[model samples]
Target: MIWEIVLFVSILYLINIVLLTIIVFKGPTIGDQVLAIDGITYGSIVLLILFSVYFKEPILTVVAIPLALWVYALDIYVSKYLERGDLGA
Candidate 1:
């Protein structure tokens, strides 16, 4: 059933989150930390979609879109800042 699939995906996502949290703590460089954070953001979006399906709420799917875009843009901004050493330059 769809519910079973959603539950499996949710569990996998949680495991990934835990692993990524460890990576964030052990990341060797600033860029590594940023990348790990991005990964977590993406995982959260997937988890949100799973919840949306489980709860039969169509609006949460729409919510995930903006969150995904925001996280991606934030990743770009951070990478740019890291590369340029200045946010406004």
Candidate 2:
């Protein structure tokens, strides 16, 4: 049962990767591309968590939280720079 769930999630993640790749390349503007990249990053983090569960190791799961937070922070920082032309200075 658990193995089936893992297989299902892995398949879904692969589909998401293909879809996001198309979106990233087909995006019309820089902002759209950035958004697509961010989406990919989010997907990667989710995939990592899924992998950690599949492998039954707590160590690999440690990366998931930091990866998610870092990507979100980067998104905010980049948006700020784009809007104001400077992050802080």
Candidate 3:
């Protein structure tokens, strides 16, 4: 039962990623594109975690945490660059 639920949710995340990819490409502004990218990354993390649970592979869950941090760092640097015209790092 739980396995089925995980599979279903993973499928939902996959669909979400596809839609977010379209939004990333067609967004009218950079802010919208960045937001879509963030969404895509988060969805990917969820999928990774789900797959980790479904497959009993702990490494994918480990990978997801650093990926989440990377996404956060990307958000910070992009915001800094947009505001200050430079990453300063």
Candidate 4:
């Protein structure tokens, strides 16, 4: 039963990643591309947590928070760069 749930979740994540990749590649605007990349980052974080549970490895889950924070910082940096043509304020 647990294995079935894990398989289902993994399949869903795979589909989510495929769709996000398409959007990232073909999005009409830069904002849309950035949003798709952010979604992919978030989906990867969820997959990391899911794999940690499936593998019974608590340590693997520990990285998700920091990964999320890094993605958020990247978003901020990109937005700033887009706005001002430089990463520095």
lDDT of each: 0.88, 0.84, 0.92, 0.88
Candidates ranked, most accurate by TM-score first: 3, 4, 1, 2
Q: Which ten residues in a row have the lowest lDDT in candidate 2?
A: 29-38
Q: What digit string (tens of lDDT, one per residue) describes model 3 on residues 1-89?
A: 99999999999999999999999999999889989999999999999999999999887688887888998898898899989997775
* Best model per lDDT: 3
As a whole number from 0 to 100, the lDDT of residue 19 in candidate 3 is 99
Model 3 stretches astray by more than 4 angstroms: none
- Candidate 3, residue 23: how far the Cα is off, in Å: 0.3
Which has the higher TM-score value, candidate number 1 or candidate number 2?
A: 1
Quick one: RMSD of model 3? 1.3
TM-score of model number 1: 0.87
lDDT of 4 by residue, 1-89 (tens): 99789868987997898899999999899889989989998888888888888888888889999878998998998899889997766
- Report the lDDT tens digits of candidate 1 across residue range 1-89: 88999989999999998999899999899788878888988898899989999999988788887877887888888888878978788
> For candidate 3, what is the TM-score?
0.92
For TM-score, candidate 1 versus 4, the one ahead is: 4
Report the backbone clash tally of model 3: 0
Deviation from truth (RMSD, Å), model 4: 1.3
Candidate 4 lDDT (Cα, 0 to 1): 0.88
